[model samples]
Target: MIEKTISGQDALPNISDAERIFAELLTGLAAAQPGFPLAQLKTFVDQEFAQIKHVLHGISLLGQCPDSINAALICRGEKMSIAIMAGVLEARGHNVTVIDPVEKLLAVGHYLESTVDIAESTRRIAASRIPADHMVLMAGFTAGNEKGELVVLGRNGSDYSAAVLAACLRADCCEIWTDVDGVYTCDPRQVPDARLLKSMSYQEAMELSYFGAKVLHPRTITPIAQFQIPCLIKNTGNPQAPGTLIGASRDEDELPVKGISNLNNMAMFSVSGPGMKGMVGMAARVFAAMSRARISVVLITQSSSEYSISFCVPQSDCVRAERAMQEEFYLELKKAYWSRWR
Candidate 1:
């Protein structure tokens, strides 16, 4: 029997949890299925895998990541779950590091000796400056308003955390592992034959994310776009599936509609005024302050006249934004353009 070797750079990139599982799968096959040609043997899953290889067909990572390359995982506090994932990646000969976002988050979590609140956990996960080539983030749940005082990334923060981390690191791309096979044009849960998109532009994915396809985090596209990072939404549950790709690089074969992503518990705000009208850098100043406060902008729209820019954000950030506007733009706040949809 011919022996196939997987090592060094070739083995490094495929060391993620999903890919490691694929290795375990191969081992099982070699043991139980015996006498098969193991050398030159390849693992091919659904049509999705074929598409995945095709997408990366031309793109190269300089040279595959070295076998001993490292990755960093950030979580709200120290988590066994993130630690476990880090271990999985490391075993495949990768160097992995796990960082608890901040001291406060960890101190409270450590006191619990077991569990902690999700929002404080996510807020504490701002990406680190130290580099690890690859970054992974996790979400304990889907959504939340922190202590009823701030809107946290909520349910899908893991995905957002990944994107945010990628943006921070300026990595080549981010790969998010979820349960679903990939991004479907329609909810496969609703429609059995829903078409899967091979690739989608950031704008298309963002629009779909707003609708309901859960592959990309609804709140992550902005950070991703800011740096033009590419993301692959693949299944951790089914690593063989062909996952969808999101980013600007899919310049070819772009589609008008990609997938549908949705947000529940969303709030909208509308503002209009002559003060807002003919305003110089008014919207920029508003958003800048929100960014400074670590408030995330969810959705936004402006009047045809450019008089105002109204945006939706986590319910938690609303009050902070309002108070900031009041204190900084008191005259504008008194006669400010403002309205909302809860």
Candidate 2:
């Protein structure tokens, strides 16, 4: 909604869609738990909706949605859902405490493109205000930036958040529940014959995720791997199924390849010329330019002759990648010493 508003695809300052969705959610919650405090939930939702409206109004005035505003909006959604979940748990006779991770647990930096400050987060978790006896229902994805602004971890960040929390708390295992049962030989939807993987090493899971497997966020494996914490990918719909386990050791399988993953909408760029041969730091310079542009290179290969280097990046980054290369190698291109192709 924020994106659409900023792009002029949505009416400025309009939050009716968010309003209707939350209303339905609250209505369902009320129906599900008649004894629950629906009034309190409604009040909380109203407060959030008002704040969202204020942000939308600011966006209208600025004609843009800044990272701060975007992150705040994302935090609000997570906050509301966590609150609702807490209410449901409370209604079930559990003593639930809704903890905002930003306020009580995780501390992050880089605002919208946030990464957890592990030391700070661990310190906060150690000094946590939540009672140990209560069922702690903490908000995921959202964290407080260094400036105390509400910020979000990146996409599929709840998994990353869980992993970070597991490592910080030194939990025995981290379970990531999703729609699918677990990791498979390939995406089961595309490859009907794909076999369900029982277990895989953290390295294997990370590689698969980096190459486009959707079971876990690529960064999710980092903290767990570092801590040697086991991770389980389970199906929410089928709890009885023994989902894939990811740990320090790999399970022996007869098949050599554990899974097959593929990335789509890729744009390949090639740099080739006689001037490229035996060029010291040439490859380094090529990647350094990409680093400066914050564009991730998915794959790279060099010719045996060392005359050319080819690399792939997401197609969406083609324009920026091209611009960065042009700027970085302006002299070489101008001198006709090397050529670039996409």
Candidate 3:
């Protein structure tokens, strides 16, 4: 909706879609408890809405959504959702404590797309703001950046947040509740015969997620794995199902390949020529260029003859990768000693 408004495709609605949905949530909660403090809950909603509107108005005036403003908007949305959940739990007579990741729980490295700065975040977590007894409700994706400004972990960050929290709190296990029953040999929607995996090693889960398993976020395993914390992937809709558990144990008698996964929208780049054969530091130089451009290489392969090296990156990074390689291998290309292909 914010994107649509910025593009002049829609009127900025009277309230954000989130606010409207949260208002309906408030109404439902009130309906369940006639004596609930509806006014108080509405006030919380109003405050959150005001902040969102303020950010939206800024976007309108600027005619662009800057990274900082976008991050702020994400933080506000997560905050509102957590607040509503807290209100609902409170209405049911539960002692709920809302913990804002931006304020306390997480510390991230970048403005919009970010990685958790585990050292700093773990330091903050050690300070221990989480209440021992209250039912804690946390903003899933928002975190504080190095500037103490609001930022977010990249897509599927909530699962990363859960793993970080579980690791920091020294929990025995981390459970990721999602729509599917558990991780499968392949995405069940695409492969009807995809088998549900009951358990997997941490390395196996990491590989599966990195290769495009949608059930677990790619980075979610890092923290938990580092702490030796087992992670359970379960279906929220079918809690009784024996979900997939990711841990240290490995089954030697199991199939060599436990799962099959694939990444889509990838572009492969190849550098080949007689110049590359037996060329010392040639592959290193090629990858250093990608690192400088901040392009993540997904996979790499080299020929036995050592005449060529090829790597894959997301399709979106194709242009940048091409430019980086061109600049890095300018002399080789100019002299006709090396060739490039995509």
Candidate 4:
């Protein structure tokens, strides 16, 4: 082992000649700054210069690729972002294709020697900027169209876009990397004891989406759900950590309901009627009336062949829906009864 002198503590174990070199890098960095944030300092080390088991490991850690990868990342127009993204994936030895502005689809297609697929981006870009295995989709942006910039999928579009691209590629599963480990009964940032769900069905994710789960977009599941593509939500922050899987994995001894996702602005409606028993199309009529008024329903539950039924809707539309329901389904309303609005 090479000899090295240090002024501070020997915190790192299994010191090696190469490791000592890396260790000296830290000292050199420290010599430049006596007071540096632990987090930021560590980030510089882990990000810029860390010992690698393999060259590929170094590439993966750098988030770059040697040739190319099968996956594609859609993001809004930002040359710096693209450059940085390319750098990271390139380090990981992945060939990343950056597609921007919806307009680039055709060009990317023509150049790649492939045809554009609308339902999903499944074109072979043999001559394109990206590789043949790469895909197409909108980039992640809040909302709106940017000129010359690739389409922003909007809100949770990246997640949806990745799923769709994965579908086009027919990948076994799509793993979403985020800051948190996985889905919990409540936001882990909020509830410390928020239980993590091992697995969740599409319906459950849908319910959560309706209740404003930031993890997924509502439109995402329907397409993939058509093909039943399972998604794993993993924490980009902690790679080795176990994340939650969203699929049809039902645990026999698990909670009948894995998690409870609640929408904040909700209005409850209670519709009751003895005459409504075995109601022919009363349920349908209630919804139809609300539809006419453009009122949205959130949750609903009814008794079996009974006179009473209850549902929830947007709090803002409660009065309008209630009035509509009361006016249309009045006869059934009198015998049984209806109350509770918002």
Candidate 5:
């Protein structure tokens, strides 16, 4: 039996719609009288189930590609998230293995108990099972930590997980299926005429990801870059579309700027004073304090005179970061070496 438990306090409402409806039925029956037409309720539930099943079957029938491709499918949610995809591939006589990422990591003795040797573990697993013609589907992001505790890879983590798997398996390419066609010149919602990019280098992709592009996580490109693997971002609803290819720089000349990315709700902090001029290690000291406080600096700009430095961080972290700076530079402030401004 699969044992699933809610974690966070606000996670109790994460049940499926079917489960919620069944609960309503139980509550209604409990409040009703002895002759409350139990048979009618059962018939209604059966009809609803049949209708839902038919709708799901219809959706599953939409994509029926005859050609089979070997891949490591790392999905967003639980197994049900990729049920239709699995069905379509299986129908085409493709052998697929639905792997539990956490369990697979444990099986290879990589994570959860000791140091994570991702490369070694993946090499062993890839060499052992799943024939050349078969595809492997896995739940992404969720894994075991060094102490055997559950860990998630944070935002856009599924994309990162997919890249990791592809690098380890030495796959020809990795693809990310999303709602949009591919990475756009700007967010379509913000810029109505935002154009799609056909291709970009891995360095550009990483920079865009860090600067607020949501297509892939910043860490997703690290392993893939090490192996010089190429990644494609495609839309699940538009499988035939040629999506953006992220890899090494092509020999052909291209535009200087491929896209624009932005993040909002940020506060800027500046450090400036006459004493800061020509001071060695002053910038390092300022940043080290933020690092110790676990504050992420979004952007940094230093004056050419070297007397002032300015940086931006999320508004949520500004207050904590300020306090950390005060504590770290108390001596400097007392000596009138620098002043902090927000």
Candidate 6:
């Protein structure tokens, strides 16, 4: 029997839902068969335990900031999810300060009780007084928009939060740790031969992510690129491996196309009529209708003759877009001024 050593970090309340589901699965298997591949199950559980330990160890190492650099950390999710990260940093003899970004900036005012004054959160992070050697961990969520309303950055808002923090603080670099080593030329799950990119330009990364690469959020690049900060994507389980780096520029590589990505469930629409030829407001009316319908146009093209316009949007929005156009051009449709292409 192998003896295992455990610490408080080992019991962190992260991924509890996952643990519950796993437990239920094992329970069901055990109930069905008294001896149902217990060895395989045990091996899987052990691997999970080891992965957790590795994560905690890697986080602790991050606390050892180099003399030349000052570090700030941003974490997403509830406080319980981040406790282990904070606890481990403090255990390593580093002063750890936990802050809520909403408290610092008026743009993202307090949600329930308190009020946030008119202050920019990015400015606050840049001007923080915490010692260079100390560490600050921010629990991040949605931020405020220009209207002072809470705006969630979507499911991957955490990545946006980290980039904002790094850009504000002018950190040397920003790193994101995930399950995979780095960004691949294509999704490895679909293309087993997909190659990992050691480094890529910000433009390439942005296009890939926007087109459908899931490694990074589309918004994650905005702040980092605005400040020209290099961002790295690394594996939490295998910290030793060099992951992908995204920067303003990289050495020219032989590959002209970085990777292939795509989006599904999309539809194209074409609006055409002789009345649209040389008409200035025709395109505007069409787009206005789409805007009013809250349908996002993905791609757009117009014929050189100005007699027709074509655009692509999410397939789910096809009906909405069509309805909006019909209402906006009811008179034109009734008079045969224009017709919608199927």
Query: lDDT for every model?
Result: 0.54, 0.83, 0.80, 0.56, 0.66, 0.67
Ranking by lDDT: 2, 3, 6, 5, 4, 1
Name the candidate, 2 or 6, with the larger lDDT value.
Answer: 2
Where model 4 places Cα greater than 4 Å from the true spot, the runs are: 1-130, 133-137, 141-155, 185-191, 198-214, 248-257, 273-279, 292-295, 303-306, 316-342
Clashes of each: 17, 0, 0, 31, 0, 0
- Model 2: residue 215 alpha-carbon error in angstroms: 1.0
After best superposition, candidate 4 residue 335: deviation in angstroms? 14
lDDT value, residue 129 of candidate 5: 79
TM-score of each: 0.45, 0.92, 0.90, 0.51, 0.70, 0.68
**Local accuracy of candidate 5 as per-residue lDDT tens digits, 1-342:** 011121112222433465466646644653554444445444555554454444334334543211110011112233333443454456567788776565554322222112224665586566567777778876666554444444455556577678778877888998888988998889999999998898999999989988888888777888788789998999999988888999988425667878899987898888898888988876687689888886778888899998898888899998899998889888878898875555
Ten-residue segment with the worst summed lDDT in candidate 2? 104-113
- Candidate 6 clash figure, as a count: 0
lDDT value for model 2: 0.83
Q: For each candidate, C-alpha RMSD in Å? A: 17.6, 2.2, 2.4, 16.4, 12.6, 14.3
Pairs in steric clash, model 6: none
The C-alpha stretches of model 5 lying farther than 4 A from their native spots are 1-94, 103-117, 251-253
- lDDT by residue for model 6 (140-227), tens: 5445444544444444767777787787677899998889999999999999999989999899999999887989976788778888
TM-score: model 4 vs. ground truth = 0.51
Candidate 2 residue-wise lDDT at 220: 89
Give the clash count for model 3.
0
lDDT tens digits by residue: candidate 3, 14-120: 46566678788878888987556778879977987787777777777777898887877766666766766776677778888766577565565567767776766
What is candidate 2's lDDT per residue for 17-131, written digit by digit as tens? 7778888988887898867778999999999888887877678767898787788887777788888888888888888766567765456555666778777788777776657
Q: What TM-score quantifies how close candidate 3 is to the native fold?
A: 0.90
Winner by TM-score: 2
Evaluation by TM-score, superior candidate among 3 and 4:
3
Q: Write the per-residue lDDT of candidate 1 for residues 1-342, one digit (tens) a residue.
A: 001111212322432444456456556655655443333233332232344334333223333322111111112222434544554455455555455433322212111111223335434544344355644534331222222221233446556656655665567988888888778888887778888788888888877776556666556677678788888889898998888888785546656545554566655656665666677776687688777765667767788887656777767667886666566566666654433212
Residue 19 of model 4, lDDT score = 48
- For model 2, which pairs clash? none
* TM-score between model 2 and native: 0.92
Model 6 — which ten-residue stretch has the worst lDDT? 67-76
C-alpha lDDT of residue 177 in model 5: 89
